[model samples]
Target: MILRAFLFLIVVWTLPAMGPWQDCEGAKACDLDGRSYHIRVPDDWDGDTALPVLLHFHGWGRQGDLIVKHQRISGHTRRRGVLLIAPNGRGRTWDFWDQGSADVPFAAAVIEDVAKRFPIDRDQIFVSGYSYGAAMAWRFACENGDGVTGLLAVSGTLRQTERCPQAPKHIRHVHGFADTVMDFPMGAGGDVTHPVALWRKALGCAAGRRLPEWQVVSFLSFERWHWDNCEGGHTVTLDLHSGGHFIPHGWIGWQLDQLMGRVPLYP
Candidate 1:
């Protein structure tokens, strides 16, 4: 009886600690070390397959719950069989200007926690955000690029220029020509293109040449620049639209398709 009791204690001690978001469905709140976030799995997920994930950040004054419920973002992720993780910034805003900010570590912690609860495809983990959240995503990519596949930034970029320890495997940034909130070409920082240029330089892409494409749907049009030649055979794309500050319709889906190697259906 004593031996059996000792075995049980060993088993209990060896078991992994329960995560705050374990067994959660739809959009549910998750807390880690006083920080909060939210998560959603695809409705058709088999629970055994290792699925890719998208860590999407919300705009200023917005929370993770909003991102989880966003039909465009969440719907595209669900249809692509990708898990969605949205982390709430402290006070509904990200402190991403500094490379040593707390949000960077908090973001990493959230990813680690989620991986503990589910089978995640570490190689396919993507990061994205809108407006201020996009700025956060940029910073996260700069600091944690080694751990992620790529970044999809919309309507925003890094708040300031800082040396990136690692660059993401790929990057796709979409912005508007007429954006006034964050400004076009120049965002919170002097040059919105700084991150892309930095990545291009870091990855050693060929100098002064990029392929351009145009895609139009109904009344919306986009001008895209593609850099296919870079170190490690990675790609960097920048999509400029004619509209004001906002994510283009079906943009995320199209980008995801391209990343997943599926035929991109323009939307």
Candidate 2:
């Protein structure tokens, strides 16, 4: 009952903040659907206090090396020592919109398995994915947001949310305005990642209006405007002038920083 009340208070806090540091490169096993994942830890772990984690999920592709390499998440982990986890979904698609309660348990399993080795900061855990993977992350946030600090989903749309959980006080999202697969204004035309505007409304941050758009001309055009604070603090949409249905290479670290509550990035 105490745990329940604590979580209740957490949800009611309105505007809140802040998880652990762990060795993602260590010998570990992540079990899902009777399948166990053999993983490797990074070589540069300095054994610091528990750190924040970035749960990176690949879209429909079988392997995610290209997205992982181009996006350059290791750079952020190298500087901040944040634990980065990459999980492969069963079959070609995630069980996101089942409406039958499948992805929630699978998500919990993944986190639990990761925690067995690394000291995972529950409040600081984050989720990110591409295409179908992004769709799953958004769905996860709606259905089982209790497991994450925030979400950084790229190029996807929203679907089947009656089973989706509430948006926590500590949350954020992103999408390309021109995304053909998951159009920007949301609904009908796009991937159903949720209308970016409406998605931002759910965060209800008090700090956003306090800060204005201070960043300069960013390479990811769409990322520039939406991510930059407009009238309100929430920035779940992007204009993506010339961009397409891919995660722009330049913006991965910045999004990760947002997940860590504006921690300064290292050079």
Candidate 3:
């Protein structure tokens, strides 16, 4: 008994201490290795149910904390019963321009860590971002989209790249016709529709057909297009607004509804 106790003590001393796991309450920040992310659960969540998750990335010069506090984002996630996760970029920005970026591994780590602590529906995982962060989302979807359900990108597109190994199951891209930061149509970065074109080519998607105008607000409307007939039952959509570089009101909510199948993809 004495020898057994000594051996047990030695084994215990050799084992590393468990790391902190943040709970999904009030958008608390969770740490994984040296990086950080924030998560929030719906108020009505029963704590045991496997809920859908939206992994949103913040734009350049922003952190995950700001995304959790944004009412437009957090409020919608709460109402939809979807868990929200916002990962902080390395040095306040993502390395999306590089093909071999560390951000990809960091993003994977964030998702894995969140799943370890929360009852997340892996099949319902969605990735989204804004501006530069949107570019990062595009990169992720291109490189690591095997298990992701969909991608909702706003006010940004992918950088110049020659290869995309995998295509996301679904893609919805929203941009402004008058956007100057990322520019409309094409800019210094590249064509805003570059990723869509790539997906179309990869999936052998039919030529895009214009959808009806979707009036979101009294003064704002979107001219939409959709490529429904594609290989592997994939989908691609693009929404162009008259506003500048910004996420329009009701935009995220409407996309979430479509993703959740509460609303049809087209009008």
Q: Pick the candidate with the highest TM-score.
A: 3
lDDT of 1 by residue, 67-129 (tens): 887877887888888889999998999998777888998999999989887889998999999
Best of the two (1, 3) by TM-score: 3
Q: Write the per-residue lDDT of candidate 3 for residues 174-211, one digit (tens) a residue.
A: 98878999876553476445546767787789878889
How would you encode candidate 2's per-residue C-alpha lDDT over 1-267 as one tens digit per residue? 999999988876632211122222323444456754333333355444565777766678543333334325555554555666666677756766555447656765777877766666777777777788777777777767655666777776464234344553344444555578755545566533344544554543222222233332355444233333333332443323355677655355666666566754432
Q: Itemize residue pairs with steric clashes in candidate 1.
A: none
**Residue 25 CA error for candidate 3 (Å)?**
4.1
| Reference-based TM-score, model 2 | 0.67
How much is the lDDT of residue 16 in candidate 1? 41
Question: Which residue runs does candidate 2 get wrong by more than 4 Å?
Answer: 1-33, 36-43, 64-71, 160-163, 185-194, 197-218, 223-241, 261-267
| Candidate 1 deviant stretches above 4 angstroms | 1-23, 186-195, 208-212
lDDT of each: 0.81, 0.55, 0.81
Task: State how far residue 107 of model 3 sits from its true place (Å).
Answer: 0.6
| RMSD of each candidate relative to the true structure | 6.9, 11.9, 8.3
- Clashing pairs for model 3 are none
TM-score of each: 0.85, 0.67, 0.85
Q: Give the winner by lDDT: 2 or 3.
A: 3
lDDT of 2: 0.55
